[model samples]
Target: MSLSGTRTHLVQTARLNTFVREAGDPSAPVLVLVHGNVSSSVFFDALIEELSDTYRMIAPDYRGYGGSERKTIDATRGMADFSDDVVALLDALEITEPVDLLGWSAGGNIVLQVAIDHPGRVRKLILEAGGSPYGFGGTHGQDGTPTAADFAGTGGGTANPDFCARLAAGDRGEEATSPLTTLRAVYVKQGFTFDPEVEQRYLDGMLATSVGDDIYPGDSVPSDNWPGSGPGTTGTNNGLSPKYLNQRAFADLDPAPPVLWIRGEDDVIVSDTSLFDLAQLGKLGAIPDYPGEDVAPTQPMVSQLRAVLEAAGEVTEIVYADCGHSPHLEHPERFVADVRAFVQ
Candidate 1:
């Protein structure tokens, strides 16, 4: 069959250059997947294939995270900034109707912000290990920091400052390291391990090409998705982009989309943050101020975030049994089946 989906490269002038994948029928529902921190569009390879027969899927390599441009000034990064990319990508595709938004880990919050900011864009939402929003100070304190630290121990494809600087600047198009396969394998096997070919392409596509790696080293994320592309001189010119970690961006948002929360019981990444994390975020220069904050500087605010979502009747909670932060990758069959049911 004509490969279920087609890949297209888009450059909106000097503003953005994004790679988009579309599968299944044009008339079918649209499914958009966003990867968490240190991850790119490659993680959804299996979901794309399984759902390709039904839904049209769109996965974008967030700036500094995938085959997109690197941002030098660090101004291009942030969850809100990434949300903007998602919105732009959809507009470019001429898809104006509500679409199914699925965000794994950090990506979940990205899509959530979009749904909250533009409710018309989403119908159903699936957050696989949807992380807590620690930046906006949801109901906690002065700083926007979540206390939960159970995120999978996967290293960012490359932590080299130079690489981070370039990747953060939004220039993943022609040069970038392949996806971190070593990390992917551990996470995959820990949760939903899959067929090898998908993993190979995923690993290959994340490189910077000069490495002569086996992967394609797609133009997203920090350099090094493919093999042989050793770390290069990416050069960091900016501070962390506000979008990559902006918590206040979601303060005004209360996305009413149907939310499915799937998590594995043993997920170390999903740590139970104390209330202090939220309180700190609220007092930060960005978040609005709250009253009577007495918790020590060490309290985590993840619980408060949970409270916020719980108040939203549209949320559905599912425990991933003994899995870690990535239940979907941990249990792909279950993940796909649940997703299919939710969208249906």
Candidate 2:
């Protein structure tokens, strides 16, 4: 599963031992790539290769995912724990100059946190199928108002137990809840396929996810609201909960960096009608006791993102037709070209 021209290694940042995948010249302007949930930096291999000639690419595994040190994510800090780890990695590498950042899915939220907290450290920002500034699920409207006081339909409890079980067991079979099936059905658009070897590599990354109450999906608490569960104060999923995570302050930054927002037109994971959103599922009758739209309306994820980024400053958006969550993999050439044109 080794990618040509890519170098993989571990860096002992102050926070943890971060496994990093690097490509291109070390002296070139750095372009840090952050991956989303259930996957690792390995997801960016193709894009790194395509843009290596002009950018020093550094993709690191988050603490509980891929080859990074396994550690408990303090959900109370939102994504600060993850963003601080990225900052520590840059410090360890002596990359004092601001670097370009590109985050995919959940990673997009982490990068936005970095830009919000450490604005001077980022030269530019790119979000690919990124999460909303208010975090994922349990919210509605462009302003991201909470559907329930407990933020019930979001976080660890929102994860499918069967999918987590299959992932923990490294089930490569194409069963409906298996990682492979999710890869094809959710990670990319329907009918899209990856090269067998590349697919295996990506699956390997997915399988590396550390499953536990203090890690993937984190922990949950019983809620009085619909779906009956709320985010617990630990784990990655809770960290992503609107209760713990919110990047709306990004708009308040004195000098926000320019942004390039890219996403697949067919992305479902972070869409307004995301299948994973409990409210959306309830509305569709997939989950019972939906509590109606007023009590628990579908989250306007894309609209929330657009509103925040627009308020922040400069933003350039690109939507690719016939694509899904992983635009870099589905349209590497265009993705790289779009990024190059922006970062340059």
Candidate 3:
């Protein structure tokens, strides 16, 4: 497909106005793409362009992201705010038939929730470096047991203030923690270089992230655990805390849709030993007063998902070697080919 003619629109859903991008024929079988935390639909534009000829690609920005109406994301709902909003977008667009769903990072979790909650509306499911079924943090063991009832090692407090500040300021520096650096170093394959022309648009999408206790990082509680912080009641990050989110129940879905779990083999954000995880960093002595593994062992996020999907018995996983968190960007051709074949 030619890399041109992408259209953007704002649709009035029941909850709020959602900003969406569309490519390809409207009547083609839809492939709904959802992006992760701190990003918007724009991140999937490339993937959409590549697959547009085969599918009607629709990517929507969640509330408080991109050009969507900014609103408080209720963490207590466990991504229900995002899932419901997606459902509303589909309804508003009059998409009654089940659609193929693809999501990356936190968005992956949202699509899973949709499949679990509304099986009739999802034809196939794809999770691209999705968060753990146990949620983002504060868990141990393959079963994803919470280290503390409060999920004391996870939540908004886990975010680096300097990094958040830089994002808010739209800092384009190549420093270790700058948004651009993070994108280059962590979001893609180690040696991959992003196109300079498209980098600023991605940065703009990242900076559009809403910050606060009720938003991106959410709130936190004091913890006896290492680093001394736990998940609090609200925010997009907190919503993924083990305190409120779990996708193990996904195995219970009847007549479950086939799932494709595609990820970069080098992903640090959602790996068995994630560099972004507090427990992993704590064990590495990066955080002071580090508690040994007994108290808060690193959560095997990939192992957890595999177990859940194995139990469900309809998952196909693809690991792209030499790739990072965003396989679509790191290995777009393979990613698109995998998605196309899997959906077919």
Candidate 3, TM-score vs. the true structure?
0.97
lDDT of 2: 0.93
Q: Highest TM-score, which number? A: 2
lDDT of 2 by residue, 1-344 (tens): 44799999999988999999999999999999999999999888888888899999999999989999999999999999999999999999999999999999999999999998898899999999999999889888888888888899888999999999999999999999999999999999999989999999999999999999988989999998899999998888999999999889999887889999999999999998988888899999999977898888999899999999999989999999999998998988888889999999
Alpha carbon deviation, residue 191, candidate 2 (Å): 0.6
State TM-scores per candidate: 0.65, 0.99, 0.97
lDDT (Cα, 0-100) at 56 in candidate 1: 86
Can you write out model 3's per-residue Cα lDDT over 1-344, one digit (the tens) per residue? 11477889899999999999998888999999999988888898888888888888999998988889988888877888899999999999999999999989999899989987778899899999988888987887878888877687787888988888898787888898898888887878677887887878888888888777767788888977677888888888888988888888889888778999998888999999999888899888888777788887888999988898888879988888888999898888888888989988
Off by over 4 Å in 3: 1-3
Runs of candidate 2 with Cα error greater than 4 angstroms are none
As a whole number from 0 to 100, the lDDT of residue 260 in candidate 3 is: 95
User: lDDT of each prediction vs. the true structure?
Assistant: 0.53, 0.93, 0.87
- After TM-score superposition, what is the CA distance of residue 307 in candidate 1 from its true location, in Å? 1.3
RMSD of each: 10.5, 0.8, 1.6
Show how many residue pairs clash in every candidate, following the order shown.
Answer: 91, 0, 1
Q: Is candidate 1 or candidate 3 better by lDDT?
A: 3
